[model samples]
Target: MRERDIVGREGRFIAEGKVVLNVLLANPAFALESLLVLENRLAGLTGQIKLCPADVPVYCVARDVMDTIAGFPMHRGILAVGRRNDRRSSEELILAMPDKALAVVLCGISNHDNMGSIFRNAAAFEADAVLIDETSCDPLYRKAIRVSVGAALKVPFAREGSIEAIVTRLQSAGFEMFALTPSGMTSIHDAKPARRTALLLGTEGEGLPKSLLENLQTFKIPMSANFDSLNVATASGIALSRFSRFSGF
Candidate 1:
């Protein structure tokens, strides 16, 4: 199938590379529909293939055939169709978190790289889950999953509703929400995060909406005076790292 076709499939997404395949095989949140591997790469993937449920199909194809099917040179030589099995709503996901929890919330995050990087950081720092707004790109998008090095597959996430509604629900659930913005009132170091915390991030150029920023307790990363901003993904890593450290997660 073409890249777009794979990404556009309902409920299913393409998981590429052996590392991602390994995650897909192990993660109970996703179900493996099938696998497509380069014929020569099959032997190397025996362990991963063995992890697949007996009912899941595995296809081995020639390099040229795989390349033509993918609409590009298939360097990774491993691909799987994975369906999201645990599709929780934002409220359901939040309600499931432990009393002491840390979450990353996204608003209008349209870039796949940023989405993937944020999920990767979330996984690295042991964030309980990621809650995405309606405007954000799907974390399960093929390129995003690839960029995350399979963290997107492993991390628990839910995408639903508007940012305002999601924020309101988080507040109702006793979560202290912190919006990360360049003009944030409190430096991240000075802010006191609660036992249950949710870090809110926005689209790269616009950042969080001014109205949203005004209501939430906001935090900013201390940076060199010359630069006012960081890439959303980099900013997430920095913010999550700091928060995770303080929260002792």
Candidate 2:
């Protein structure tokens, strides 16, 4: 199971923590294969276990045994394997949203922690969906799911496309794309919301590519001159919050 830390199992991800496990068991969109719980945790999770599909097995193991099997300390004492049911394309997902939509678009966000926190922010701000480029890390990666506090599972997301193409599609679908960068021309607060808006974010150090930045309207969070930049996740939270308020997210 620890191997999942490196490469997740095909079409499946490991969910940790009582909260994440509860999300896995609660969402019909995900199908649980099995649950491994510490013997001590089993009694507390009995209600959740009964809600699992009859075919799905719940294994109870001693704390030491669970730790040994997990190849780590396994402090949460709760892990579950699950697969997603709704794997929609980016175009389909975008098309399904309301005319006025708020979306978070990511480019070159390879850090799993950043990816997770972005998802959490997107969920917190009630983004209609998150669109990640082919270069971004998998939002469903185990550590990402864990770091997101299960928001990775809650937010709708799609990946695998050129950043340019993704931007074009969003424009074609009536979304006004705003590239968020430190050097952006307009302050995020001053930018008016469109019928549908896509907030494009990039890795903190590099920011968005110049070509993409030139192609779309750009906005930035107004900050003191002392700091060069905000963490990509933190920037996303601020931008999404502003956009969500305007878009009625």
Candidate 3:
């Protein structure tokens, strides 16, 4: 467990806290490997713990031992190791989404918190899927999952090779890609939603690369003076909210 603490063990990820543990237990997409909880927490989590397959082990340990194993103060008193069972390639993910879909495409978003929040927003707005480029952080990173409030577990996502590859696949799949940037040719409010829509976002400082921006339809959230743009995650929330409302979730 301690070894997994530093770097997620192989393909395994640590699901921490009561809420994240619950999501891991309830979601079949994640295959349970093992569970460790402070003895006091065992009572509260017993019901859910029992739902795990008989083969999956659940251990109750002293708080100090748990903390030592985690290499930190284990305030949440809960931890579980799980692996994703239904991994899909980017092409497959795009092909599987609904004919009328709304998705978020991320490019070069390195911050884990922003990635987590983006997933949370995607789930909140009932987005069909999230497509992240190679430059983005892993949504399954321990901190990212916790920041997402378990929304990362609930939402389906695929990490593709590059922004260009992602755009190509989405375009081939009949998606109308709208790149979100400050120098957009159109305003997000005036842009019409399509049967298959993708809202593309980039990193905070540089935004989307010129190559991508030049090729795709670009739109921006109109803002007042003094501020040129919003944070990537904030902009994503605003855009997702607008798109979901326009397209009926």
State the displacement of the C-alpha of residue 181, model 3, in Å, after optimal TM-score superposition: 0.7
For 1-249, candidate 2 gives per-residue lDDT tens digits of 455553445567888888888777767767888889999888898789888889998899998888888888999999888888768889988998887789889999999999999988998888989998999999888889998888888888888798998888898899999889988999988988777989999987777899888878889899998966889999998888788864554
Top-lDDT candidate index: 1
Which residue pairs collide, candidate 3? none
Error of 2 at 141 (Å): 1.1
Candidate closest to the true structure, highest TM-score: 1
Q: For model 3, give the 10-residue run with minimal summed lDDT.
A: 1-10
Task: Write one digit per residue (lDDT tens) for candidate 1, span 58-142.
Answer: 9999999999888899899998889888978989999999998899999999999889899999999989999999999999999
Query: Candidate 2 at residue 24, lDDT?
Result: 75
TM agreement with the true structure for every prediction: 0.96, 0.94, 0.94
lDDT of 3 by residue, 1-249 (tens): 454454445567877898988888788888878888899988898788878899989889998999888889899998888888768888888989998898889999999899999999998989988999998889988888998999889988988698899999999999999899988999888888788999999999888999778888999899976865688889999888888854554
Model 3 TM-score, all chains together: 0.94
Clashes of 1: 0
